[model samples]
Target chain A: MNKVITINLGGNAYQLEEGGYDALRSYLDAAGRRLEGNPDRDEIIADIERAIADKVRGVLGANKTVVLAREVAAIIAEMGPVEDTADADTAAGTPESTPAAAPGTAGAKIPPRRLYKIREGAMVSGVCNGLAAYFRVDVTLVRLVFAFVTFFYGTGLLVYIILAIVIPSAETTEEKAAAQGTPAATAQEFIRRARAGYYEGMRTFGDRKAHREWRRRFKDEMRDWSRDFRQEMHQHANRWWQQGGPTWTPRSGAWFALPFLSLFLGLIAILGLWVGYTLITSGTVIGLPLPASMPVWVAILFLIVVIQAIRWPFKAMRRSYYCGGYGPPCCGPLGFLWHLCVWAAVIWFIYWLTQGGHSATLHDLAQHLPGKLHHALSSLKQWWEQL
Target chain B: MSVNEKFSSLRKGLLEFLVLKVIAGDKVYAADILQELSGTEFATQEGTLYPLLSKLRREELVDYEWKESEAGPPRKYYRLTAKGREQLQETLDYWQKINATLKNLGLKSRP
Candidate 1:
């Protein structure tokens, strides 16, 4: 069974077989490409579709409403190829050239088609027409394609609306000409070149009128340049931050904490080294006896403090690298809490060492320790006594 | 160029003049213009006529008004402007001169 597709042609609706729709759509597209940039683009396409719709209606009598591919092909053949119609127009314009040159070839120098909504004959935003010209498709078919997409997903409307808003309207003849990629210098560019006296030098003229013309063009060029510059600056002001330009947003909190973190890390390093040096040479750390002959608990606590001090800087560096984008390991308050934990761990280790050095605490810890550790401590005590 | 190509160009050269002459006679719609040209060698499609009409309109040689039609849609009724009449007169005079010259040379312009 053939699937039927609904299509709106020249304000009239018809249900056509899917294959017939494709055939008709492609035929219309060919016609549209040939007539791109013509002032009567919309009217011509509408007329063709109207004629075809009338023919299709005749073919689909009172009983059968479905239009098959063969019927569409027959209708297209009766209408004739779009190129013949275009040729007739071209011949009307330039009678000397039989089989007029393709619209796309502009003396072998076709400029890239720029996106611009044509001002004249625009329905709604003119995006569909502009796109049709750019893609060399029928405006009607382009609109139909957009309608289908919008019906299925609804993104087509959003995209079309955004394009309509963003694409500048081609208000002037020069803009309309350039919209079709005709390599014509814009008025601004012409004025700039004239002011530079490029064309003036080529002409063998050293007259006052020539100089006066140059001065006038120079004035116009300067005015246009200044206006464009002001407009650009105004636009930039709105999106300066996103473009990575200079902005007034306050520095991130990380910037403020960086110096403090460096200072704290340095202090911890110095304290850990001082404690280690004092314990090794003078048998004391922070005015507390944390000697090599202390209880196993005090020794283990000192080892942990030294290891943490060594690992702190490397861990912070890794965290910063990861926070750049890789992982959300250290960020804002979480980072601060991590630093607080490190500080607390170091201080607690220091406090434990000071108390563990006391003879009463050592004896308490000694009783709780395993018998093997007690024997080892007693042997160290005997050795210290001999020394 | 081939004979066919030359003939195509020859036919094309007369289309605008013919179109102006047709519009000058009566206020015509696009379909009417095509129908009138159907008997002539200048018979063309609506696609070609619309563009030419619009170009003529832009040049102030022709003007059109959107008139409600009993047919399918509102059609653009086109009429020749004063500028168009003057252009048609000039073109006709030139063509007559050319035809006279061709006749003097023992060649007739008419098929």
Candidate 2:
């Protein structure tokens, strides 16, 4: 027969059957472990307790004493499963194997768990430490990568802001454990590695009610993971783009000169041959060709100067310093070389076109003007120079 | 002399001197205090102890400070106040009377 007893909980006295007390004790022990990181633990526990009490009152109102364990178990099943401490206890380390509170000896009170903002940070969601608990990676690596991403494409920073908002902060002992990568902590990153842990079987006790809650959390994790994964992919692609479009990539300081360099090099090659060929063709624009009779070897030398002399040297310099990642250059010399080459090409092309034999294009504009008009323009230029 | 006589006396008979005795020896955080109690088989739900200590604080019997931790947030440590020491003195005196009364009846061992 079940015996009557009044056990004190916290400061409140609870009158329950002997059988009920044992069940409550075991259930609470299990529930405490599960409720570690969950924010709504107290509310959930209170609700479950009230439900159990109501069930007990209903049964005992008719029968004065001697309630069965079956009655309480039935009620608990409707609330949620009891923690499966068998395996969890091994992982819990200290709390499980330790004895429950002893009588007469003073209990040292534990302060409530608190969440402080992390320090020594880079742009990693301020939540990377939190994420590391989930993923089990070195904090340093996360920080390093985070720095690089923020340095380039600072716009990508909004992703971290989104994460800090979307991801729940750890604020309790259980949450801290999870945030630190302890087994059984519900850290989403940790849960991801467990493979088998996704649903990890129906909870041991509180079968019906717990199932509903479990399903909800599972769905939430899926959505959050998908969003996080997508963000990660985007960052990776942006990094690859910054490396180079093809041979000799561009950089910010030197990147702006790329278009001008191409134009300069093309103009130099055209002018070199055209002017040399113009000199060969009696200074008329007779489809300028390389001055072949002037010695093919010198022409070859001239071609080298045309392409490689100014621009190629700078191209080599730009090639040397071309490091990627907007965070900061780790001293990439090729990048500097490429920039120099571009400048050389543009400068040399402009220099040759003016000083080298006149191009038909420049001469044509001169010829198009009427003789009288041309004389008047020359005189106007002289007048302005004198002033 | 009815139920309260039995239950109240039962509650009162268990001297709360343990409370003073616990705090008298050393400074402690609430968690350590609970842990010490558990070792002695005195079970406590965190819910119960926090309120008890909060009352102690309110009465100016105890004081606490927030201390930082490397891995986590700051912790609060409790120390006895001057008023707390006076309360302890009064409790000791009251205990002496109960022991004296029992002694007058020619009962008990060490007073």
DockQ of each: 0.09, 0.01
Residue-wise C-alpha lDDT for candidate 1, range A1-387, written one tens digit per residue: 455788987667888865566556655665666678777677777867876666777787678878865666566655544433334444443312423433212122334678888644344458988888777778889877766555432345556766876899876434555586654432233334445653444353366786566557646744754565465556556565576663223336756665676767677667765665455435676677765568544654555456565756655554464354333433445655554444444444444445533335455665578986878999999999999
Please name the candidate that would achieve the greatest DockQ relative to the true structure.
1
lDDT (0 to 1) per candidate: 0.62, 0.48
lDDT of 2 at A380: 100
TM-score of chain B of 2: 0.70
Worst 10 residues of 1 chain A by lDDT: A101-110
In Å, residue A272's CA in model 2 sits off its true spot by 76
Off by over 4 Å in 1: A57-60, A81-387, B1-3, B69-71, B106-111
Candidate 2, A116-136: lDDT as tens digits: 223223222347666554566
Query: What pairs collide in candidate 1?
Result: none
